[model samples]
Target: MSDVNLATIDLNLLNVVATVLAERSATKAAVKLYVTQSAVSNAMKRAREVFGDPLVVRESYGLTPTTRGAELLPALRAWLEEARRLVAKAPVFDPRTSTRTFTVACSDAVAIALLQPVLRLLKKWAPSTRLRLLTLDRLIAGDGLARGEVDLLIGIPPVMPPGLEAELVYRDPLECIVRRDHPQVRSKLTLSLYASLPHVDLALFGDIDDTIDRALARHGKAREVAVALPHFSSIPLAVLETDCVATISSRIARAFAARMPLKVLEPPLALEPIEIRQVWHRRSETDAAVGFLRSLVREAAG
Candidate 1:
């Protein structure tokens, strides 16, 4: 293959490629680009001829990207966005008057603990901006951010993929949760008592068992998990109905106790604190709208 210089390539074709990838259909791309369907089809032919790849192929629903298309989408989109931003006039994001949407991906625990405060602040400060909270499957957090599917992700960091930017919002200690009326609540929970109690475990992305098990091993003990769930929100109800103790974030544990009959105890054994962070893609680092939303999240978390 000849070494072709991308500098000599026509940039307009990049825009067409990005549109096709986003719309996934020549008809849809034509509608979006306000051009004829034939024009869109011609653009696709030119793209294939230039790149020597059938970028997209018809699939059951619409279009599926080929390997080359998949590899080019991110860089092409980022390049086009950067080019546009360099030449386009910047619009001031007046949140109070602008009707904009911010999508956040986070676990239910952070959503329950911080969303209300964030919404309250938005109502007072950016009344017209709307918020969408998505419960992210923990494994997909990095992928979601990288693909621009979610505007922000709030959770423990070091879990996020490389190249994403994260800020420490708050540090919350781990605490033990049990029924307020449980027999164990009346006495100090020794390491033996803690391990002996039936446990309700929360397995976010199927890794909770490994985390807690490692912690237990440090004390030469292991928890007898009677129940395991995917969300922290369900632990309160599970504890209320059964003789089970749950290890959870102090923020979430206290939030649960305010509404439910639950007891919060300091874990008898020393465990590492969980640091909650707000993570976003580097593409949004300088976006005015995303900047406002990030500030709002930081304030709410405080």
Candidate 2:
């Protein structure tokens, strides 16, 4: 045989040959391959010229493969099968066996309210997988996602970074937290009483451009921020020690209330609930592992 140069050959002709041989009729092969009967005939003509053989011959009842055609059948089918496997979509992610370490970026408060539950679900479903939680910075969040530094972003940024896709995980309503035995506060809080008390603010970012303050400003009222802490974990403890009342997310407030001697009460101001979203770059649109992680987060949020 002469040297078989792949660059000069139409591999599609081989598929035509395999189909014709299997079906034992050009008409049947045409139906299977979704092509006209003439197309199948033309493909056979080209194949005959390339291999220099009458690859198939017509018999009494139907078409029959020649010795050369029979030899080509197995090889052609094997190549087609391998080609299909090569072009197929990615396999489904198996959380039970996956060792993928997903990185999520969000505020410390979000980690407390959201990730704590996510961690429990992961522990049960994806025992081998790992999690890396990074502090959120809205300014650099988009870049981090594009760079593949973080797999997911979850938090309430005043402005979401452009070019990323987001879905609402849940809304976190604001609530006021104080020591259980706060002197001035009882069952209900009035706007005037709320403004009169000292406040303990949790500043995720260094600057304290908070929603609570903005809401208070709309009502022509303001509270004295006795202390501003950068971490969410410290706010509950700070409230426990002093008479300062902190307005925080209802999720975090109730969570801390269950453990500490803290009281969770509705905030006096009509502040909008914080929208927590799960964000990711469009590049990971079809990534199985990332999709699995997102599903777990959705479950946790619910």
Candidate 3:
């Protein structure tokens, strides 16, 4: 059922109704529109009659929009924004002046490899923008993207969720990292030696869908996991003090080895490389801010 009475309604009152509901006061809406308060009050009366409801009500401090009024907000805002954009000259996204918050999801390994460098670029170029980095949890990430809770996702996903798009940005091979002083790994790390050594399994994330385990199982061999912990940053320190070797992406291993006493060796088993990607929802494909953030990520990865 609809309450639209076409004969007596003035279409322009819709703007007045939106403005009144937004400002929560007829006087404020009139001031914003540079019109008299009485004019706005009359317009509001006609708008209420047209809609057959009191769209806004007087509370103690201010007026509040009713449920029907609240429901109209998004479409009304979009319509008003489109109207403004139509009259504006040369609309473009200026990141330097935009105070936007961008969200990114990735594995701890990817964060260890790329987060700092990407933050450096963002701080230098888009000073006012903020970045929120969350660890990748595939189970809920797809829902987050759909609900606009997540902005961009980086790293390998077992499968791309529907309504999402991705671009492969880089690849890193799996490698075994060990302390330089490890007694048994003097020359060529052999499969028998690797299986014999204690292993540090990355267990920071809840799900344990590991490629290393799958690769090992394929060859009918299993490595003993001496310890399991979260965070790739701590893996180096963990391996430094123990006889355990950690299997991780080569880039993360290189980054850690460059700063610490760690050695990167190709994993004895033929484990597939990790493919890093930047993923976003299809609905955000044409958004300028999202485009800018994606470019920044691609540049940092490159």
Candidate 4:
């Protein structure tokens, strides 16, 4: 409330006052600020004169804030919080209207599993950003991920090419799902009964070369594949209406069962866990739009 010129006053002096109030001792404040105790004392003395109040009074053990200083503490803390947030936020990215476009490479399996939730996130966050999906046949290795044609990839791959950033999107263990009214599966699915059932096999994503069937073969057990489909999305529907059982990753199975008349059952075989990852090129590490999209993907997957 002084009539002094604002420009003449160092705003940084307010930081010193806040620090002293927090520490309750000039000696502690000086240690924290890497300045001498005399400097803190001088700043406080000036602050007292400027405010026309004893900002700190010497007590037997240390110092305590006077009435005016105590009254100002809450405002000072709030100001610090606001200032920190303003400094920490990214200046370039604004998801609500960003127009950045990115191409993501993945399999139809991933599309079937994650597309809906991811699209919902896009609508809520980066509404204007364009997402182009590249299927399995289109994926290839090229330049560093950050500088490549594929901005993001979400699926199981034989190799996580170097120079790319990747992390687990979701881990889906194998499980069997069948129609609720399945006659053969009245109760527990024993190994022999599982092998007897005609299974709906998803041929997409290189199932021929994948290890699931091979693992079953290793155990001297295999199921009769009566129906072969392109992707997992159709397999769930086929399974919901017919006696054909499908072995799918728990993630997609759970999602399908949540709405369909299907029931999840533990598979007899100890299948390896399925892993989906969010992979992006390292080149896009500093791209604000790409980073925001990655966050949305993570949130959706969670």
Candidate 1 residues 1-302, lDDT tens each? 78988887766888888899988998898898899989888888989989899999998899888999999999998998899899998788898897988989888999988989999999998898889888777327447788887889898755656779988889899898899899766646788888889999888766555677787899899888898888888889999999899988899999998999888999998888898888999998878888999899999988
lDDT per residue as tens, model 2, 1-302: 56889999898998999999999999999999999999999999999998889889999888999999999999989999999999998777899998889999888888888877899999999999999988776427456887888899887645665668889999988899999999988988899999999999976667775677788889999889998999999999899989999988899999999999988998877988878888998889889899989999999999
Query: Distance (Å) between predicted and true CA of 268, model 1?
Result: 0.1
- Name the regions of candidate 3 deviating beyond 4 angstroms: 1-91, 137-142, 217-220
Give the CA lDDT, 0 to 100, for residue 39 in model 3: 93
Clashes of each: 0, 0, 1, 5
Candidate 1 regions with alpha-carbon error over 4 angstroms: 1-86, 138-142
Indicate whether candidate 2 or candidate 4 has the larger TM-score. 2
Question: Which pairs of residues collide in candidate 4?
Answer: 145-281, 146-281, 146-282, 146-283, 146-284
Write down the RMSD of candidate 1 (Cα, Å).
13.6
lDDT of 3 by residue, 1-302 (tens): 86756676676787888899889988899999889999999998887777778888899988899998888767778888888889887557798998989988887788888888899999888999999887666526457788888888888776786999999889888788999999888756888888889988777664444667777778787778887877778889989999999988888999999999888887787888888998899988878889999999988887
* Candidate 1 CA-lDDT value: 0.86
lDDT of each: 0.86, 0.88, 0.84, 0.81
**Clash-forming residue pairs, model 2:** none
Pick the winner on TM-score between candidates 1 and 2.
1
For candidate 3, give the lDDT of residue 10: 79
Among all candidates shown, the one with the greatest lDDT: 2
After TM-score superposition, what is the CA distance of residue 12 in candidate 2 from its true location, in Å?
Answer: 16
